[model samples]
Target: MSLLSPKVPALNDPVLVNEWMAVATAADISKPTRVSVLGEDLVVWRSSTGVHAFRDLCIHRGTALSLGKVSDDQLVCPYHGWHFNGEGQCTLIPAQPNMPIPTKAKAFSYPCEEKYGLIWVSLGSPAHGVPEFMEADDQAFHTIICGPYIVNAEAPRVIENFLDVSHLMWVHEGFLGVPEHSVIPEYHVHEREGKLVTDTITVFQPDPDGRGKDVNNDYVYQVLRPLTVQFTKTDDQGSDVFAIMLHTTPLAHRKTMAYAVLTRNYGFELDDKQFSDFQDKIFSQDETILLSQRPEELPLDLAAELHIKSDRLAIAYRKWLRDLGVEVGVA
Candidate 1:
């Protein structure tokens, strides 16, 4: 395909375009919010029916529809007062009241849905639905939405960072790990029904929970989607279980947004704010390192970067993305 070919935009590789990426939290779209996904600008909004996502462009005069107000379940264009409904249909043209609206006056739209308290958008036909967060189904777990953290890095880099366990001892320090037990145990990672799952990864944490005691923690990781990953962590006693589902959206080649769903069986007595705050602090630490990374885009080639035994999961993740032919945020 030529560089000028409209059929193949630089960032619209099918492997990524066909995958669903979380654009915003459900509460973030109370109004017409502009979002960038797969290098395309999008406007996401909520209607009485459900959440809707459309290209941020208004076809009339090439104006941004996000600058317009949404009224009577229609997104009005700020340029010429064209009203578009949730289905991307132009219903009214204020300039010529009696004139029939042209079928081609519609705004380009994409498939979107709300799940796990977040809004997801797909630029092309989705190969699969939103990745499952099974903890949401269990009533015993207390669910907390963590963040929509913006990182100056590629989407795959964000996902790889979430799946990385060796960084805990160095980056998270006393909270998630300790220097005395920094050596990571050899772990197993394999594919199951198209999803990558890792065997139990053990780590010693100075404070695994609010209890403030050191204990060995066990974690099992899963690659839910190209840009979505999850991990379940438990203590040696198996009494406490906490899980996090991380969703990443590639806003552009070097920018990304991440949202996390945290679920725990315990911590019911504790305020949800405490958990949210802790996660915020952890991500803050990660953001600094993520931004300082030399090459912002993740390297898909296995030999591009040296790997240690502890990096097995990250290795599998990169290979999966390479095999999938992801083109938006990698070398």
Candidate 2:
């Protein structure tokens, strides 16, 4: 719940897909739950066989399968008592128990995998495998999954904002940056094989907790898809290496839910609550700024907005989305 009313983005165009997006946390889908993957309505659940994802609409009457319940190891539609198997095959219809289930009674099943406590779903056949974040599996690194922060902004805007380092000084002062060091130092941008990367950016910034002296660290932001961005930080700090991931589950054209996972080489002594609170604070700043952005959607036109040298990566990101023919929330 929020003090300000939330704005749900309107679904006006078809969503595109390339990356395997995290649709739900594994724990959240212990039972059946409705989710949207690249704008496709889905119902994800955990069964004895494993995790399964199906088009939420029932083959019979188009009722949302999510409104149904799990029964006898299968998803049962509430309206008609139709039971579906893990493979989305309608195995039993209480109204017609003696009749054999037809092949056409099956629902569409999508590709799904779980990693880092998240359920990753692909709207299309994925060419790339499920993504891995740094230090998530390392015993030495202390990691914490931070959020499902709901942001009332376009999915692409969330990615562009995460890739944008220049906003730190103005939008995240005192925590992520200070106005005194707002001048962005020269850095290179690289794009190849469907990934846009920043060339080792260094900025004088404060620790996210607003404690101790500031540390100047090098950053690497990787734009893996139209709506996924990640960054790594390294410096003479508590953590030998720090990594952050920003992934958005697009519920609609301009509405999204953001999730962040952080892996740190240090912070073994830090309490999870304290660490999570700090992360919440930092992300709240971004959420406030992003929701207020003009046009509400991300513009694919490079000329839509003025760009500084620091925004070279943002420009490259727009081009990537354009090349991929993404239209949802895109100009």
Candidate 3:
């Protein structure tokens, strides 16, 4: 469809609208969890077969299917007692016990998948597969699922914050990086395929999780998608690499959820609570400062904001987003 074709409303293709976002964890869906992604409410549930996600509203009476239960391999709606099967087809309507369900009664369903202990959904047609973090699937590394942090800023900006390690010194002083050691050496920023990558970063940081020995860490940062970024860090002396995936999901223009997953070989024997606490402390610092950036929307215009040599990654991230035809709520 052309941009001038009747000036029509854009179609919502979950996989194509934006990069995949982790809307819920697999554990969150016992019966069905109501997850909101970029203003679309989805009902995601787990069944004996696999995980399933739908548009959340019942076709019969516009009631939330999430408020209901799963019975006999179908999602039952609370209002008017309508039942939808895994494919979002209306199978049973209690009022008309024998009436055949029509094809139009099907709910708009999304392509949902579970990876790295999180439920990822897309509201657009996806030309590419979901992002890959092989460590999360490999057996050698122990994995810990991190937060569903609700940052009070737009997704693009929150994602930019993840690629911006320069702020760690001031914003996350005691926990993440110290002001005394804030020097960022010149790192070359280049794009591999479609992602922005930089690998020449080395920093002196304490053990991020309070368990490992402090050392100078070599880091490789990658902007996997507009709202997805990751970093792999390995202390110079250790053989283990701590890989983290930081993904931001836009619930709306100004509301976003940050989901993280960490894979490491060092802290497998440590208590899970300490790992959780340490992550919480670090992100709490980022959340406090990110919420205060004015014009909260990410700047696509290169000159809209000033930049320095250390902000090469952030600059590259914004340029990549602009090149992809991405806006606030769409990709």
Candidate 4:
């Protein structure tokens, strides 16, 4: 089947779009990590000097380079004694004692950067820099790094959920969402700098019942392509907004490895333990639903079939992708 057919988007192709991959925690060749972005197998690891990313497959025998070892800032293939450096250059060859290793034996390389406790890889030429923690510099609030999660759905679908606010009453009722008795919220969608930003604000009037008191909250989501989302929540008493940024890199046509960072801005004492606990609860809730979704891309021309006021954000997002010259599947 064609890659971009109605049933599936061309997620594997390198020309589609770029995505963020993983975080850099430690430096050891014995610890090899595999990441999939744009349907390509990316092998990320730390050498003695810094981090490096290369195509996972070895050039000589086609063994996974990620399964190899790191020795003296060079990746040594486990199958054959071929060594490659950070620039994907073949530096050493055990079989050839006198002959210099041919350049053809080198592996394919990708651009990777280590920042904000994460390792980011670019599948395409990304003009915008790697996603940063905006709240980290604010002294009024503490910052936390919420570890990554692997979601089953596509990156766009996962981001749509973060942009959705109407679902709060039903999906996250008891935990973070308002009750059914609360007034329905007002929503607005805007575009800024080739990106779509959504804001949903609801004010909780003084209610006779205490259940609806905390319903007065505002949720704002900013979608920054090719896969970064910022979620902010503001309220009356000492505003606390957490920015959940997601970087989804495609593993295949049906799977993705999603790297997420939750940056919190609480104008009070918020320690690591408290922030970690909060993130754990919220992410655990989201994981259950996202992982259960059908492992397939939604029809590209969904606008022709279903239409709703709440779908405005979804439509705008699809349009933004289309505007970037990405091929939207046929109806």
Candidate 5:
């Protein structure tokens, strides 16, 4: 099979196909924790000030530096007591007598930043800013931060699930999906500053069994390259709801870690506990299905497969990625 075929590529390729693989999560690597990415073992450490990342292997004997300890602002190797600073330069060598440390004795360092309640590392120079939570600053909205969940699927497939509203009816069934509705909502797809933005409006009427009254909901979905999806909802009553779903996949390509925040416009009489419960319920519904998918590599055949008009947004998203030079399987 071809390297870019259904078979997954090695994690150490010169160019990482996706940007989401670079995000650093607390659960993945806390202070003094070591993780591997792009074929290089790395250690992430915290000092009195902030966090730093460097190659985990010591330059002296190739021992894992993460197995060592943090001394003030420097990382001390456990094997030879060599000390390295936040800049990855070896600062001290206990055994060397009156000899200056060689300038070349430095560990490879990567640029990292903490944003949106997560740590992000850059494999290559990122020209764009980190993903932002659109509704985070709105005082009228109450926000809840749910923990991360590991899903066994490619990042693209997982993202497709969020962009695909059609699956809401079948995949979600009784939870939040509308199964009986046969009508497709009107949607608009446009590009904004190199990002794909989609707006869709769907109306729901009262069921004969007395489920709910007539309601119209508008959804806004934006795709920021590499790995970020923003979803905003507005109801007929002008009630606004916003959510940001961030997928940070590991370099291993076997799992994806996601962080989700759900918020609704404040001023409602609902208590904090009630609002928390509501957000949890909706996220739980998505978690259950995402965790069940196989961790297959991307490039799906959507054309040979069955599709409906409701899949318009999902199809557009795939095409957009392809236009950006992403490899996708053709029917």
Candidate 6:
């Protein structure tokens, strides 16, 4: 949170501060918009320079700049009509044009950039660039950006749910898996290039691709960042493949919004809306179960939750969170 707003929870965790989080889609910010990440309210907007992110509060009166408008590539303060340029420096003080603007009289700005149809912001200097999505660069794949599915639970829980295959048989019945074929094959997970990558874990899916065929689906999971994870699902012959990148934004302590970037080799014949709706159904199922989880926050202590053979991925995820010293969304 900003020092100006001491009442808000602090988001100064070293790991989280230096990491970039997706605050909005590139299409969502034509005008000044308010978005929360790690408990700080930021106003994200697009200017001639590029996408800009700054504290939502105007220094003059602490009014939310998001309530204001943009003109001539500058953000206008809603209360005093102060004009701030894309660099976040106060350029014009409507009432006192002759006075010199104080160096401190500026909107608190942060580093921001646009990539993969999303606007990413870092409250502090970024440790590294955004996670990689190889399929996004491949021309053979059709890519679609999905939801910012707002969930009531914290981010880690939502991410862990995405990494979990155990719930497929029950929660996603008939879509991803069925109880009759609930058995999970052994898989391997290890660290590679600062990421947790998993070997193929095969599961039986009743109707995975909407073709209504029962087939064994092989999955490989990777944790690219503390809050970003992905999985690649393929057929036995590796002729067909689907990959999804899951990015979660911590809106607040117990609130998070998840976005998915889906790329598939097949499905070119299907409408993009159909693929979006299909994911909407899958996420909706997880949302229900996630909301019902107790304590809201994910327990960093492994002993707090029971683990089984299939939970190895989740176990590694929790360890990763703990190792990073992330304190925002875990116990």
Model 6 TM-score is 0.93
Ranking by TM-score: 6, 1, 3, 2, 4, 5
Q: In candidate 4, which residue ranges exceed 4 Å CA deviation? A: 1-10, 13-15, 22-30, 137-141, 181-184, 203-215, 267-274, 277-280, 287-296, 299-307, 325-331
- Predictions in order: lDDT: 0.85, 0.78, 0.78, 0.62, 0.61, 0.88
Q: For residue 321, what is the lDDT in candidate 2? A: 83
What is the C-alpha lDDT profile of model 2 across 162-221, one tens digit per residue? 888999888888767889999888887888666788888887778754345578878888
Question: How do the residues 1-331 of candidate 6 rate in per-residue lDDT, one tens digit apiece?
Answer: 4424333335557788888899889999978999988888899988988999988898888899999999989999999999999888999998989999877778888889988889999888787998889987798998989998998889999999999988899998998999998888888789999999988899888977566667788999999999999999998777889899999988877889899999999868888887788899999999999999987888989889889988999999999899989988889
Judge candidate 1 at residue 135 and give its lDDT: 81
User: Which stretch of 10 consecutive residues in model 3 shows the poorest summed lDDT?
Assistant: 2-11
TM-score of each: 0.93, 0.89, 0.92, 0.79, 0.78, 0.93
Which window of 10 residues has the lowest lDDT sum in candidate 1? 1-10
**What count of clashes does model 6 give?**
0
When 2 and 6 are scored with TM-score, the better candidate is 6
Q: Return the clash pairs for model 4, or none.
A: 23-118, 23-119
Q: How does residue 212 of candidate 3 score in lDDT?
A: 49
Please give the lDDT score at residue 28 for candidate 1. Answer: 88
Error of 2 at 112 (Å): 1.8
On the 0 to 100 scale, the lDDT of residue 290 in model 1 is 90
Off by over 4 Å in 6: 1-12, 211-213
- TM for candidate 4 is 0.79
